[model samples]
Target: MPNALSESRACLPPPHPPEVAKGVILDARHALVHAEQGWMAIADVHFGYEARRRRAGALLPDWGMPQCERVLHELVRDHQPKRLILVGDIMDGSGTVEETLELLKRLTESVKIICVLGNHDRAGLKRGMSMIPSHREGEFLFEHGHLPLSDHEGVIVTGHEHPATHFRDGAGLRLKLPTMVQEQISAKTQRWILPAFSPWAAGGEYTSEHKRLQTWACGKGRVWRV
Candidate 1:
């Protein structure tokens, strides 16, 4: 693997944070942040999803890791957060976790990385990285959203659904883009599901009939309210 930086890696640029809550910022690259504490939250990266699919007879291109690396590098460069909390599902298979470990070895030098294990990430936890079951930041409970949520769960922040929407770009080209779904469950509680950061994420357009669901759709370097 080549670790050389591209002189002009113009394709993947860092995104600006679109304020979702009082202190919560969602960047176009699919990162959620609590700015006051310098903590960045991300979920549903599925690092080896493509490779897993390919092995399962899906004709997918092997482009997941490099793309993830580019987005991550750009994200770190732009935000420079003190800590990065991956909510869950960082990889789909063991081979992919090994790849992720190699990437983390370099990333850990600059940013402290933490991975909250997701259903597809058992192998990653066994690798001895900074893996945790759940992380609490301020009043937020950061975890993989597959488990049941209770009233006592506090303000939940997660990613697993890979929510998205279909929309036209500035060039008028229709595209399936990732989305951030926020639902206010109660007077004092809220759950936010972030879009997948992997460029190859097999996301479907999300449509909701619920009255309380608020969505922010993102593409390229911009976010559009939906």
Candidate 2:
């Protein structure tokens, strides 16, 4: 198994051009290029995941709206992107209707919101929302990473791993650091797997030699510690 720091560095995909068209690749999650839209694309909010677990008697704490609000606020204020693309899993389940609505309301004033549906999102939770399977930006493709694509011709960005790397200190204490994975999908396609923005979420260890990462084509990508 690879150490956390080594694994993190190894998983990072090749760096985007200093200038991609008009946008700069901001971290591995989204691109902040100066375009007609001036947009930032993020994937997998998975809002209300804690609430869903609590409903199942999991006794999770209430960190839903506040956590999401903080991340969203920072991203908007820092980047000032006119458009925000939520790639998928905006809500954990149908049970978090009120919180989800409140979050949407708070975000309406600052930027335009675009959402795609993840596998966990059911029809009942997305009744009136316009959720798409995939979103295209210039030559980039954005999805939730739960589904597979037939081809990889452009940059593919997704979030589902909720990735974290485990590090051991001098005292032999293990710590899991959240991270982002970047790599090439094929000769012509690039892939970026983002760390979950939600504070109340859990993630898999990046160093684990599991089939899941292999399926996502994460074997030798570069990982960025968050």
Worst 10 residues of 1 by lDDT: 7-16
Instruction: Give residue 27's error in model 2 in angstroms.
Output: 5.4
- Which residue runs of candidate 1 sit more than 4 Å off their true CA positions? 1-16, 54-59, 150-154, 168-174, 205-213
Per-prediction CA RMSD (Å): 8.7, 7.3
Model 2 error, position 161 (Å): 1.6
Highest lDDT model number: 1
What does candidate 2's lDDT look like per residue over 77-154, in tens digits?
A: 877877788867777777876677678767978988777777766776566567788887777677888878537687
- What's the TM for model 1? 0.82
TM-score of each: 0.82, 0.73
Q: Model 2 Cα RMSD, Å? A: 7.3
The local lDDT score (0 to 100) that residue 199 gets in candidate 2 is: 60
> In candidate 2, what residue range of length 10 has the lowest lDDT sum?
213-222
